[model samples]
Target: MNIVVIGAGLTGANAVEELRNQGYAGDITLIGAEPHLPYERPPLSKGLLLGTAEPGSVFAHDHDWYADHQVDLRLGSPVTELDLGRRRVGVTGTQIAYDRLLLATGASPRRLPLAEPSNPDVVYLRTLDDALRLRARLTGHILIIGAGWIGLEVAAAARQADATVTVVEAGSLPLLGVLGPELAPLFVGLHREHGVDLRLSTTVDSLTGTQVDLSDGTRIHADTVLVGIGAKPEDQLAAQAGLATDNGVLVDARLRTSDPHVCAAGDVANHDHPRLRRLRVEHWDNAIQQGKHAARTMLGDDTPYVRQPYFFTDQYDLGMEYVGHVGHAGYDEVVIRGDADTRVLTAFWIRDNEVRAGMHLNDWDAIDPIRSLVEQGTTDLDALRDPEAALPVPSG
Candidate 1:
């Protein structure tokens, strides 16, 4: 059997590895648009931006691992066309035929409209090269236009590098969309405590020669501007191939696309999740788990991709691990254990008296039990909000 994976990111790399690990004696071709090996992207905004992590430490596998495993790894090859009828893909004047194909093409950072497009100081973080370039310019006054995870994380890194940092957000609080108005203030305090000049309920009106004009008739001078608004999935290849797409390539519970021979995972896949209905996740853990699951499905595994959603982030003294599917689910009440003022707590999102999701900040030991609570659909709010209350074990 011949398999071609059209991405070399974390998801694509894991798919190839799982295929080989499952003892599939087939021709596997892994193609990546970037010149570098498959590397983890979470570090790009944190450790890599702070210059604390080594360049090679983030790679999924070493360079020689591909050759030793008998996998054809192609770098710097972008698939320009996908021929579903011919069962082939066009990559820079070359054609490769495949019996099965997995599309792990990830996402790209959303670009903002700036008056000066030629300004070298304006940047966006997405890849290793982008991180490296941003790192080099982390010595001056840095202005970040967005209060999302990426924007806040880069602010943390910039502050750590002794750079004067400012974050501008149109919302009243940082991370308001993700964590809601109640919990978003915690992050607002976190950045403010770390000496970040956070301007809330504000927007960047224009950027002209390092002077950023704001919507509230104010201007801030900056040496470098990093835009972290959000990202859009790279699903053009799948859409062009006649695959069903809605925000991303639509896939079933098994990660199978519209065409049986084609599948998608990672950020590009809008999967029909078991508990969350249809959702598209753009996190590190989702990429790894979905990639492996997609590979297993290709190898005749019938198990549905039902792993609970998980993601984490580190900024200054705050380290958080969240597990749940609450992006769209409406939760009635939020239960909290410990003190939010102290910045060490475990919070649960409850809907219909059932725990839908939970997050731990500066508390590492609660993840497993918190995950168990969410999975078991615990409805005891009193016990959940009590730090001393024992968590119930899952019944077989």
Candidate 2:
């Protein structure tokens, strides 16, 4: 059988490696738009941006890794169209046949509708090229719009780069949409402690030259303006191929798209969760695990993607680790494992006296037990809340 996996992000790369590991000896093709080989992306905003890691350190595997695995690696060639009827993909101008196709094409940065499109000062980061461009333009007084993870991360990197940074968020607080309003200030404090001029509950009315017009009739001067308002999934090809789509290309619990021959994964594919049901995740762990599952399924394995989504972010001195969706409506209380002001804590979102989600800072030992409780839905709130209690036993 011939397999083609589009997009060379973490998901696609992991899928290819997993296929080989799973003893799939059939022909395989991995198509990637970027000229670079499969590389890790989380470092783009952290280590790579901060100059702590060398340019070559972020790749998942070197160029020769693909050839050794006997996989056809198509770098710098982007698929423009998907012909489902003929089971072919239009890459650049050529069409390639595939017995089974995996759509892992990741997301792209959102372009703001600018009143003045001529200004070349606004920048967005998603790929290596975007990071390189942003790095070159980093100068004094950088103003970033949005306080999401990317915005906050860039702010951290910009400050480390010795550029005066300011982040403006339209929400009441930074990361409220993701981490909840209560926990948002922790990140806000993280930025402010580093001397970032964080402006919450504000919006930029317009951008003219180096000045940003504010909704409050104020103007801020910026040497560089970055918008990290989040990204939309690249589902055009899947949708055009008549696949089901919501926020992303919709797939079933098995990661199989509407078309049986097509499977999807990563940020682009929104698949049903085996345990959570009807839920879709866009986290790093989800992408890697789901990609592997999709590849196995394509190789005729009947396994469903069942890994609980996980993600982490490192900013300044804080290390955040999260599991499951925190603070679901059914969750009635949160158990704080440690004092928030001390910069060390683990917050367990409790629902019906069971641990639903776990968030920890500098507490690595607490994650596994809490994760077990979350997965099994049998956490004892009383024992968990007790600091003296031993870590909960792993459930069956």
Candidate 3:
């Protein structure tokens, strides 16, 4: 059997490894567009941006691991097209046949609209190469265009490196599009406490040299600009291959695409989550977990991906943790455990008297109980909010 995995990001890398672990003796080929081998992305904005990363520390697994598994690792080779009828992929100038194919093509950075002869000062942090360039340029007075997780994480690193950071958001609050307004203010306070100048409800007209002209008629001088507006999934291949796609390449609970032999995972997959019903999550944990699940499913294992959603971000000395799923209409009430102004607390999103989702700031200890409540579908909000209350024991 011949198996090929496209895109060498976290999802593709983990999927390849999981395939080998499941006792697959098939010929495996992993292809990546980027020159470097697979590496963790979470650190690219943090340690790599802050110049704290050690040498030879980024690969998900060492170089020897590939040789040990007898996997054909192809770097700098991108799959240009998928020929479903031929059961092959056109790469560079060659067509590679595959019994099974996994499309783990990750997302690309959201670029800003700038005129020709682009300014060299504008930076976007996404790949390892992007992080390396931004690390050298981010000395002082950095302007970030968006207030999402990527933008905010880079701001935190810049602040720690003693660089002046300013975050501009077009929305009324930062991260309102993802986490919603209920948990957005907590992040606003986090950045402010770390000495970051956060501008909310501001739109950028254009970038002229080091000055950012906003629609509000305000100009901010910046040494370097980093834009993290959002990411668009690379679903053109799946869609072009005649697979069902919506926002991302649509996949079932088994991670199988419209074509059973073709599968997808990671940020680019719009999976039918069993518990959440339908969700297109671009979370790191989801990518890793789903990639493993997809690989297992490909190997004839029928186990469903059952883990709940999880993601975390570090800002200054605080760690923000989020678990479970929360929809816009579900959260009828919110309960705050700690002070939001001071930025030391936990906010639980309650729907039908059950904890559907939660945001924690320096409150990691309280997460497990809340996660249990979400999983069990318990509707007792009053008891869940009180830390001292005994959790409802599960029956055997």
Q: Which tens-of-lDDT digit does each residue in 229-348 have in candidate 1?
A: 999999999988899999999999999999999999999999998877898999999999999999999898989998888999999989999988776767888888878998898888
lDDT of 2 by residue, 1-396 (tens): 899999988899999999999999999999998998877778877888877877699888888899999989999998898999899999988998999999998888777675255677888878877777787766799999988888988898998888999898898898775566557778888899999999878898988887899776779999888988888899998888888899898888889999999999999988787766666666678778888999989988887777677888878778888887643364677777787886688777767667677778888787787677778766666788897886575646
Report the lDDT tens digits of candidate 3 across residue range 214-305: 87898989999888988988999889989899988998888889998988899888888787776777778887988888898888787667
**Residue 71, model 3: Cα distance from true site in angstroms:** 0.7
Q: Per-prediction TM-score, please?
A: 0.97, 0.95, 0.94
How big is the positional error of residue 238 in model 3, measured in Å on the Cα after superposition? 1.5
Q: Considering summed lDDT, which 10 consecutive residues are worst modelled in model 3? A: 387-396
| Ranking of models by TM-score | 1, 2, 3
Give the runs in model 1 whose Cα sits over 4 Å from its true position.
393-396
- Candidate closer to the true structure by lDDT (higher is better), 1 or 2: 1
Native-to-model Cα distance after best TM-score fit, residue 343 in candidate 2, in Å:
1.2
- Model 1 pairs whose backbones collide: none
Error of 3 at 352 (Å): 2.6
Off by over 4 Å in 3: 115-117, 390-396
